[model samples]
Target chain A: MLSEFDLIAQYFTRPPRANGQVALGVGDDCALLTPTAGMQLAISSDMLVSGRHFFADVDPYTLGHKSLAVNLSDLAAMGARPLGFTLALALPEARAEWLAPFAKGLLALADLHHCELIGGDTTKGPLNICITIFGETAPGQALRRDAAKIGDDIWVSGTLGDARLALAGYRLNACKNDPDEPLGGQINLDASNHALAAARMHQPTPRVALGLALRGIAHAAIDISDGLIGDLGHILQRSGVGAKLSVDDLPLGAVLAQQPQTIQRHFALAGGDDYELCFTAAAAQREAVLTAAQNASTKVTRIGSIVADPGIAFVAADGTALDLQLSSFDHFRTT
Target chain B: MLSEFDLIAQYFTRPPRANGQVALGVGDDCALLTPTAGMQLAISSDMLVSGRHFFADVDPYTLGHKSLAVNLSDLAAMGARPLGFTLALALPEARAEWLAPFAKGLLALADLHHCELIGGDTTKGPLNICITIFGETAPGQALRRDAAKIGDDIWVSGTLGDARLALAGYRLNACKNDPDEPLGGQINLDASNHALAAARMHQPTPRVALGLALRGIAHAAIDISDGLIGDLGHILQRSGVGAKLSVDDLPLGAVLAQQPQTIQRHFALAGGDDYELCFTAAAAQREAVLTAAQNASTKVTRIGSIVADPGIAFVAADGTALDLQLSSFDHFRTT
Candidate 1:
């Protein structure tokens, strides 16, 4: 059996890439990093367990990508430029077949963003991956959740509900037509839609460039990890404000739109793991906000407006308030 | 049952202390840290799991101290000053009783070192704790394992083998002697020795001050986590040199000194979790090294010297080379 050190040396310890931020990478007690002058370091941590975060048989490569991607999303929400990350992994055993692809997926994204793997620990235990990411941002430039102000327009990047649809398809096995379910009214996804949703679920893009572009334009920001409404609620709570979200304007991918209207609304409002940035910007910056989205090569939809009230209100297309009981996934909450 | 968010807010979240290094701490998507200009960031991660790293019934307070202590030790080895840390904790349940003392112990040490708890994730899973620590060092001033030179004196900070002795005593139940094996001689620790060993095992100081002091005086340094000989071997291998260790000169605590000679040697050479700094310096710098240690208020013992040869030699008091099979703990080793 390969030892933890051997595994790390063989797979994780690559020659340091020419990232000036990383002064020292791996092979030492600690890695040394040099943040740019006048830049504040943005750091975040995320942990993923086998059963809780993903299926036991989930693709190792996708698991690797999602693990780092989730942590990167936190940085993205903060409008920070990725610098380096450390992975603390606990594995049941040292299996080369599983590790090779996992490293590939992890490093591919790291390379894409110019983020280096600085240092981490490997141990033998239940399969769990914890990543702590470091990034850099100019002082007072981060999109903070407590910075939202009255009359700011709430915006969301990309489309939501696709990942949730992908999950629902997997859970209900609805990718295939089931004649017996004609009366059961289960939603079925076509192969093309299925592929789109699955990709959205498995390999999320962290919208890093979009966040960087929104650094100065957005008043407050948060990533849509625990659905749009719940996450936006966090911003509102922190800012001591509220929001009025337009249900009809909520961005929905074509695949998610084909579902029942109620399902579409539910998934878009409450399903988690979208990994898209939700931010609020002053109405006067509308032109600049659109330019920022274009510069980052991402789409942004104006979904709501911040208000002085203390709770969220959902407005339907008919101008009637939509009352929906919704809650995000709480780890300790009993089903 | 407390939700993960509630648990974090109740137990882990605290007001940002007046550490100017932390720009933004807990309650954000990412913690913002400000590293000193012209200083490099030193980062390290360590994970501890129940049943594997500690006893199932280990005190949450000690476990908390140890979980963060081990990671800080890595920074200490690099001669970095503690800045802040992120704790990713996966707990089986959110029990207030267990969390209270755990947080108390963790924050007490953090306060001592001025290391703020920046940000991290709390999840429901098998009990595990992963801490990623951040520190700062002057550019190129880190004490590295690859910097040892030939003929440099090897020095170790503080005493060794006491933690291992405590472990053995606990494993062997030495406090309650068994009369059935009269011929089986096992060293018994008195109350004072037991207290010393237990304290060493439960709450290991990271030697951060000593490491910071050794930056210019020492050529190479490492924390003796996996015993002296094995960890020193890392320095030798990395520095392209060997060492000649005089076992008679090794600093032993009072408890370890009372053990049989063989047991004392074995514990000193192969035991793990000592968390003491082992460093090398030029022979001419011995007085400076002693002064550095004195400035840090830590004891330093010169035990060996770097040699031109490629293998370590252990010599007895009579100058005879000793042949003993010693190996450090390998997590994946089946035996």
Candidate 2:
């Protein structure tokens, strides 16, 4: 029976750790942060609801990590450095067990990026976690959605589809939708691969460094949260351009690569929640792009090229248009 | 059925109207804001959930206005001017009839404060609204809770207790807990008074102008979402000081004034959700405080003085200590 104030003081309240940026922190009417001179502040918010966004028994540690990670990804997409974040949490009850690990996981990531937990509100209700993150970028250096050129090359960081594959496998195995299938109707994945996929799904490493490096190197950037094709469509819509993506060049880890060709392509292109950086850069900046990737110690693969035509085309190895109609997961459509 | 994207685009999206400060607005991974040089960004978040914060059938319009108003009140307490905000919404379903009015109320308030709707995530779930608002104040100009000094005069803007009175009357009437009461076994209030109290509960005017004018004039400040004594306890705790409050001097509008003396004092002292600005200033600055209130066109009343003692004493008009155990609403305790 912890009061909301006690709950906040115990689990959420922390000393102001983001020095230089945070002027005032928690236990105030409003937290204050001073933006660096010549820098623009980038802000975004995301909410995760139980049952809809995560399972009731999902690991609180992973849940906490995912909550802030998604927000940091937004800053990453904008090529902004993480500054601080405020969390608004609603809980059915204040269980110390869940909160301890949850706070640990959340703060670990925050500490890693120097994104202090500045201020937040906690209330008793159905479980919901909303985080609003702030970041900063120099006046004109932010990677924007509308800045892509027609002839720019489209690139994706790290691998894609593993998280979605993990989700699909877990759903197939746990729900046993295909009752006639063998092995308890479960799509059994190798233990290591399953773990990797699950880790990707649960604990996405935001591409903060890669994004900072790509600030001037990339023109338009977006984080791959709604799968590659759909998120790329956002850039296309904003920049008023088209893209030609080669299925052959789509980045995939060994686990995802071992899947059936259709499954691999589907998951790689339309499976959401990868949380990787996708960007468009000038073809002439190929060397610079490589240098930036090397500087970040992250893998960057060119997967497509932007075109003047105003529609996306998925191409095969022979340059023929793929006839497959794969669409990303839309929350309303899925429901 | 509306997908999350469509819901956001139709109900939440708008052309970037917060021009000069916003570098990028909606339709991006993150909204970018350029704070004025030598200014500090003030940030605060608030969450309102159905059943917990409001009735399920509460007018979507008032809910929208309130959802943002409460957050704005936090900024107002800090003497911060509204800049922009990000909304994270969870809806049980996408009902246009409900959403239309909700968005209208929300955007109207945003327009009034020039608080741009910058970026947010919309999801399908239990109805909840969380808004994180951003504002700015110049260096050393923002009002703070810990800045109160012993001997500083305590002042409250506008009236108090109407919202709490409204809640109490509604609860008492609907529940009929006291069968001994008259008027169909329920306490009765006149129509006009009830309407005034209800409006106070529903749409609190955040004292933004008074707060802006209080910069350098007020030593410490807080907006009374919680009751006077409880919220003022925050300033006491932070400032390491206590107060001697004159219950007689507590400001009350006609509706609250008509209540029984005990009930009036209880609600005015410890009943929450008033949203009026309670500030502290040096006794010598009385004239300046009056000037600030005059400039903002808001009423201000001095009710107490901060003392070096570590506990509050509510005194009677005859200088006798009032031994009333009035505590503010603690959500967990209330539940």
Candidate 3:
């Protein structure tokens, strides 16, 4: 068996980047990072465990990508530019086949965002991946959940529910393949649609560029990790406001568009792991919002408007209030 | 079953600290932290998994303390002042009995250090705790592992090896009480002494004050988590220097003082989980080093001298060299 130090050196250690914010990288008691003057550090942590967060036989490369991508999504929600991150991994064994591609997928995203992997810890245990990411933004420029104002237009970037759609497919396929597997409600998806949705689930694109572009424009923002209704509720609760959402206006994922209207509404409204940004902006900034989306090459859809009342009212296309029973993904309750 | 949000609000959430460094805490996409002007941020992450880092049936309170304590020790090694920390926890279930005391112990330490609990993620899985701690220090003032110089006097703060002794006691006691348990080498330890050693293992002091006091005085330093010989070897390898260690001069813990000579030497030399400061300073600065230790109320012991050679030489009190076979704890190779 490879020693821990050797394993880290072989898989995780990288040459220090020139002109990087990190003064010292790995092989130290603590990594030293120089925050830019007049900037605030934005920090977030996310942990993914096998069989709970992902399937036991998930691809190591995609698992690594999703791990850091989810954390980077948090930074994107805050309109913070990626700086550095630390990974704490627990693995049952140090396998060369698994580690090689895992590091490759993780570092590829880190490199694209100019984010450095400064330091981390690896130990022997059941597989778990936890990343704490750091980013920097000017003071008062970060889009916070509490900053939403009544009458602001609520917009969402890209599509939602593809990841959740993929999850349903996986559950259904597992039940069909093995009768002993627990049944999750029935769902039908073609192989091509399943692959597209799975890609969205495994390789989420963090809207860092869009987040940076929306700085000073977005009144409030949050990444859609726990479904739209539940995540948007966070903004509503924190800002002491409500929302008038057009249920028919939600941008459906290409794969979900093929499903029935009921499935489309449910998946798009309450599906988790979307990793898309739901942001609020001034009603007059509609043109600017479109321009920003164009500049980042990401699609944007106006789905609703913030209201002074305290609860969300779902409206159908013909202006009738829709009564739906839906809940966001809760790790403890749902799992 | 409690939801993830309710669980966080019930046990982990605390009121914002007065005049704290954190601009935003929990309930946000990311926590915002303001770094002191002209200070560099120091970051470190540590992950503890059940059955690997701690006993499966370990007390939740002590486990909580140890989880954060080890991460804080890394900040102490860098001579950094505590700022804030992000926790990522995984639990099999939400049991109030376990979470209550666990959060109490964790937050108690954070309050003592004035380190706010900013933001984190809670999920359902096999129990694991990962904390990424941040601290601040003036540039060029951090005690780095690569600063050790030839001819510098090697010093250590606090006692060593008690944690390893306690571990041996636990192993021996388990074997004696349960025939099905794996047999570890037999060791006799009275209950009183065992308790003393166990406390050292559970609740370790981070030596932050001593690290601050020795900011410019010590040329290089590292916290000894993996035993003296191995950790000191890191400084030597980093600085391209070696050391001449006096085997008899090592400071033994109170409980280890009663052990046989061979046991004392082995435990002090290669036993892991010690969390003490092993540092090196100029030969002429011995008095200054002593004063710094005195001010911090921590004991300082000089046990060796840096050498121009490329490997450590063990010297006995009688001025003769002795060869010993020893290795530091490796997470993958060890249990």
Which candidate has the highest DockQ of all? Answer: 3
lDDT accuracy of residue A27 in candidate 2:
81
Looking at model 1, residue B309 earns an lDDT score of 97
Q: Could you tally the backbone clashes for each prediction?
A: 0, 0, 0
Each model's DockQ?
Answer: 0.58, 0.66, 0.70
- Rank by lDDT, highest first: 3, 2, 1
Docking class of 1: medium
Please give the distance, in angstroms, between residue B34's alpha carbon in candidate 2 and its true position after superposition. 0.9
Q: For candidate 3, lDDT tens digit of each residue in A1-335?
A: 23653575459897986646899998899999999998999999998889877887889899878889999999999999999999999888888888988999999899888899999999888888999999999999999999999999999999987888888787677666543212233356989999999999889999999999999889999999888988999999999999999999999999988887877888899888888999999999999999999988999999999999888899999999999777666211132
Tens digits of per-residue lDDT, candidate 3, B1-335, equal 23753565469887898646799998899999999998999999998889877887888898878888888899999999989999898888888888988898888888888888898888888888999999999999999999999889999999987888888787677666543212233355899999999998888888888989999999999998888888898899999999999999999999988887777777888787888999999999999999999999999999999999998899999979989766666211142
Q: Would you estimate the TM-scores of all the predictions?
A: 0.94, 0.95, 0.96
In model 2, the runs with Cα more than 4 Å from the true position are A1-5, A178-192, A330-335, B1-5, B178-187, B190-192, B330-335
Residue A17 of model 1 has an lDDT of: 82
Candidate 1 chain A: worst-modelled 10 consecutive residues by lDDT: A326-335
Looking at model 2, residue B170 earns an lDDT score of 64
Best-performing candidate as measured by TM-score = 3
Tell me the TM-score of model 2. 0.95
